[model samples]
Target: MNWDTIQGNWKQFKGQAQQKWGDLTDDDLDKAEGNREELEGRIQEKYGRSKEEAKKEVDDFMSSL
Candidate 1:
Protein backbone atom coordinates (compact mmCIF):
# COMPACT_ATOMS: atom_id res chain seq x y z
CA MET A 1 0.00 0.00 0.00
CA ASN A 2 1.05 3.58 -0.55
CA TRP A 3 2.16 5.91 2.26
CA ASP A 4 -1.09 7.80 2.02
CA THR A 5 -3.10 4.64 2.49
CA ILE A 6 -0.92 3.47 5.34
CA GLN A 7 -1.06 6.84 7.05
CA GLY A 8 -4.79 6.93 6.68
CA ASN A 9 -5.04 3.45 8.14
CA TRP A 10 -2.35 3.70 10.79
CA LYS A 11 -4.57 2.31 13.51
CA GLN A 12 -4.68 -0.93 11.58
CA PHE A 13 -1.12 -1.02 10.26
CA LYS A 14 0.61 -0.17 13.55
CA GLY A 15 -0.02 -3.71 14.73
CA GLN A 16 1.84 -5.03 11.72
CA ALA A 17 4.69 -2.68 12.42
CA GLN A 18 4.87 -3.80 16.04
CA GLN A 19 5.08 -7.38 14.83
CA LYS A 20 7.89 -6.55 12.45
CA TRP A 21 9.80 -4.59 15.10
CA GLY A 22 9.17 -6.50 18.27
CA ASP A 23 11.15 -4.15 20.49
CA LEU A 24 8.81 -1.25 19.79
CA THR A 25 6.25 -0.67 22.49
CA ASP A 26 2.64 0.35 22.02
CA ASP A 27 3.55 3.84 23.21
CA ASP A 28 5.97 4.25 20.35
CA LEU A 29 3.38 3.38 17.72
CA ASP A 30 0.82 5.53 19.47
CA LYS A 31 3.20 8.47 19.34
CA ALA A 32 3.95 7.90 15.67
CA GLU A 33 0.23 8.23 14.88
CA GLY A 34 0.61 7.77 11.11
CA ASN A 35 3.75 9.83 10.71
CA ARG A 36 6.46 7.96 8.80
CA GLU A 37 9.33 10.02 10.12
CA GLU A 38 8.19 9.52 13.69
CA LEU A 39 7.94 5.80 13.13
CA GLU A 40 11.43 5.79 11.69
CA GLY A 41 12.68 7.62 14.76
CA ARG A 42 11.07 5.08 17.07
CA ILE A 43 12.68 2.24 15.14
CA GLN A 44 16.02 4.00 15.13
CA GLU A 45 15.89 4.44 18.91
CA LYS A 46 14.64 0.94 19.70
CA TYR A 47 16.72 -0.99 17.19
CA GLY A 48 19.97 0.98 17.54
CA ARG A 49 19.86 1.58 13.79
CA SER A 50 21.22 4.50 11.86
CA LYS A 51 18.71 7.03 10.52
CA GLU A 52 19.36 5.77 6.99
CA GLU A 53 18.87 2.16 8.04
CA ALA A 54 15.60 3.00 9.77
CA LYS A 55 14.35 4.87 6.74
CA LYS A 56 15.34 1.99 4.46
CA GLU A 57 13.60 -0.48 6.76
CA VAL A 58 10.44 1.62 6.75
CA ASP A 59 10.64 1.87 2.98
CA ASP A 60 11.05 -1.87 2.70
CA PHE A 61 8.09 -2.38 5.02
CA MET A 62 5.97 -0.10 2.89
CA SER A 63 7.07 -1.94 -0.25
CA SER A 64 6.16 -5.25 1.34
CA LEU A 65 2.70 -3.96 2.11
Candidate 2:
Protein backbone atom coordinates (compact mmCIF):
# COMPACT_ATOMS: atom_id res chain seq x y z
CA MET A 1 0.00 0.00 0.00
CA ASN A 2 0.94 3.66 -0.40
CA TRP A 3 1.65 6.36 2.15
CA ASP A 4 -1.71 7.99 1.65
CA THR A 5 -3.54 4.79 2.48
CA ILE A 6 -1.37 4.26 5.51
CA GLN A 7 -1.92 7.81 6.70
CA GLY A 8 -5.65 7.46 6.30
CA ASN A 9 -5.62 4.23 8.22
CA TRP A 10 -3.19 5.32 10.90
CA LYS A 11 -5.37 4.48 13.87
CA GLN A 12 -5.43 0.82 12.93
CA PHE A 13 -1.74 0.68 12.05
CA LYS A 14 -0.59 2.28 15.29
CA GLY A 15 -0.86 -1.03 17.07
CA GLN A 16 1.36 -2.74 14.52
CA ALA A 17 3.87 0.06 14.78
CA GLN A 18 3.93 -0.26 18.53
CA GLN A 19 4.53 -3.99 18.22
CA LYS A 20 7.32 -3.47 15.72
CA TRP A 21 9.02 -0.86 17.89
CA GLY A 22 8.27 -1.92 21.39
CA ASP A 23 10.47 0.70 22.96
CA LEU A 24 8.28 3.44 21.60
CA THR A 25 5.41 4.69 23.72
CA ASP A 26 1.85 5.11 22.47
CA ASP A 27 2.42 8.86 22.73
CA ASP A 28 5.33 8.60 20.37
CA LEU A 29 3.34 6.78 17.70
CA ASP A 30 0.41 9.07 18.24
CA LYS A 31 2.65 12.02 17.64
CA ALA A 32 3.61 10.58 14.28
CA GLU A 33 -0.05 10.51 13.22
CA GLY A 34 0.97 8.42 10.20
CA ASN A 35 3.31 10.98 8.75
CA ARG A 36 6.35 9.09 7.45
CA GLU A 37 8.79 11.85 8.31
CA GLU A 38 7.44 12.13 11.85
CA LEU A 39 7.63 8.38 12.34
CA GLU A 40 11.23 8.34 11.13
CA GLY A 41 12.06 11.26 13.38
CA ARG A 42 10.60 9.48 16.40
CA ILE A 43 12.58 6.34 15.57
CA GLN A 44 15.76 8.32 15.22
CA GLU A 45 15.19 10.02 18.55
CA LYS A 46 14.17 6.90 20.45
CA TYR A 47 16.73 4.53 18.95
CA GLY A 48 19.55 6.99 18.22
CA ARG A 49 19.66 5.84 14.64
CA SER A 50 20.90 7.89 11.74
CA LYS A 51 18.26 9.54 9.56
CA GLU A 52 19.05 7.23 6.66
CA GLU A 53 18.80 4.20 8.91
CA ALA A 54 15.50 5.37 10.34
CA LYS A 55 14.10 5.88 6.87
CA LYS A 56 15.23 2.43 5.85
CA GLU A 57 13.60 0.96 8.94
CA VAL A 58 10.32 2.65 8.13
CA ASP A 59 10.57 1.37 4.59
CA ASP A 60 11.04 -2.13 5.89
CA PHE A 61 8.10 -1.67 8.25
CA MET A 62 5.97 -0.59 5.33
CA SER A 63 7.01 -3.67 3.36
CA SER A 64 6.01 -5.92 6.25
CA LEU A 65 2.59 -4.32 6.35
Candidate 3:
Protein backbone atom coordinates (compact mmCIF):
# COMPACT_ATOMS: atom_id res chain seq x y z
CA MET A 1 0.00 0.00 0.00
CA ASN A 2 1.01 3.55 -0.68
CA TRP A 3 1.12 6.49 1.68
CA ASP A 4 -2.40 7.51 0.83
CA THR A 5 -3.82 4.11 1.53
CA ILE A 6 -1.96 3.94 4.79
CA GLN A 7 -3.24 7.33 5.81
CA GLY A 8 -6.76 6.58 4.75
CA ASN A 9 -6.94 3.33 6.59
CA TRP A 10 -4.86 4.24 9.60
CA LYS A 11 -7.62 3.82 12.12
CA GLN A 12 -8.19 0.27 10.98
CA PHE A 13 -4.57 -0.60 10.41
CA LYS A 14 -3.31 0.80 13.70
CA GLY A 15 -4.64 -2.15 15.62
CA GLN A 16 -2.70 -4.47 13.39
CA ALA A 17 0.34 -2.30 13.80
CA GLN A 18 0.05 -2.50 17.55
CA GLN A 19 -0.29 -6.25 17.36
CA LYS A 20 2.89 -6.53 15.32
CA TRP A 21 4.86 -3.97 17.31
CA GLY A 22 3.60 -4.11 20.84
CA ASP A 23 6.23 -1.68 21.95
CA LEU A 24 4.64 1.00 19.81
CA THR A 25 2.30 3.12 21.82
CA ASP A 26 -0.92 4.66 20.58
CA ASP A 27 0.77 8.04 20.96
CA ASP A 28 3.47 6.93 18.57
CA LEU A 29 0.93 5.85 16.03
CA ASP A 30 -0.94 9.10 16.51
CA LYS A 31 2.23 11.03 15.97
CA ALA A 32 3.00 8.99 12.90
CA GLU A 33 -0.52 9.71 11.63
CA GLY A 34 -0.18 7.86 8.37
CA ASN A 35 3.24 9.07 7.30
CA ARG A 36 5.13 6.00 6.18
CA GLU A 37 8.56 7.47 6.77
CA GLU A 38 7.56 8.70 10.20
CA LEU A 39 6.09 5.36 11.07
CA GLU A 40 9.31 3.61 10.08
CA GLY A 41 11.36 6.14 11.97
CA ARG A 42 9.29 5.72 15.11
CA ILE A 43 9.50 1.96 14.87
CA GLN A 44 13.23 2.13 14.36
CA GLU A 45 13.62 4.40 17.36
CA LYS A 46 11.34 2.40 19.61
CA TYR A 47 12.59 -1.03 18.58
CA GLY A 48 16.21 -0.18 17.82
CA ARG A 49 15.91 -1.67 14.38
CA SER A 50 17.84 -0.52 11.34
CA LYS A 51 16.14 1.73 8.81
CA GLU A 52 15.98 -1.05 6.26
CA GLU A 53 14.52 -3.48 8.76
CA ALA A 54 11.89 -0.99 9.88
CA LYS A 55 10.90 -0.22 6.33
CA LYS A 56 10.72 -3.89 5.44
CA GLU A 57 8.56 -4.68 8.45
CA VAL A 58 6.16 -1.86 7.70
CA ASP A 59 6.01 -2.84 4.06
CA ASP A 60 5.34 -6.45 4.94
CA PHE A 61 2.65 -5.47 7.41
CA MET A 62 0.91 -3.23 4.95
CA SER A 63 1.18 -5.82 2.19
CA SER A 64 -0.33 -8.46 4.43
CA LEU A 65 -3.61 -6.60 4.10
Q: What's the lDDT for all of these models?
A: 0.93, 0.93, 0.90
In angstroms, what RMSD does candidate 3 have relative to the true structure? 1.1
Evaluated against the true structure, the overall lDDT of model 2 is 0.93
The number of clashing residue pairs in each candidate reads 1, 0, 0
TM-score of each: 0.95, 0.95, 0.90
Which segments of candidate 1 are over 4 A away from where they belong? Answer: none
> Lowest-scoring 10 consecutive residues by lDDT in candidate 1?
1-10
| Model 2, C-alpha of 56: deviation from truth (Å) | 0.4
57: Cα error in model 3, Å: 0.5
Best by TM-score: 2
Q: Give the TM-score of candidate 2.
A: 0.95
Off by over 4 Å in 2: none
* Poorest stretch of ten by lDDT in candidate 2: 1-10
Writing each residue's lDDT as its tens digit, candidate 1 over 1-65 gives 78899999999998999999999999999999989999999999998999999999999999988
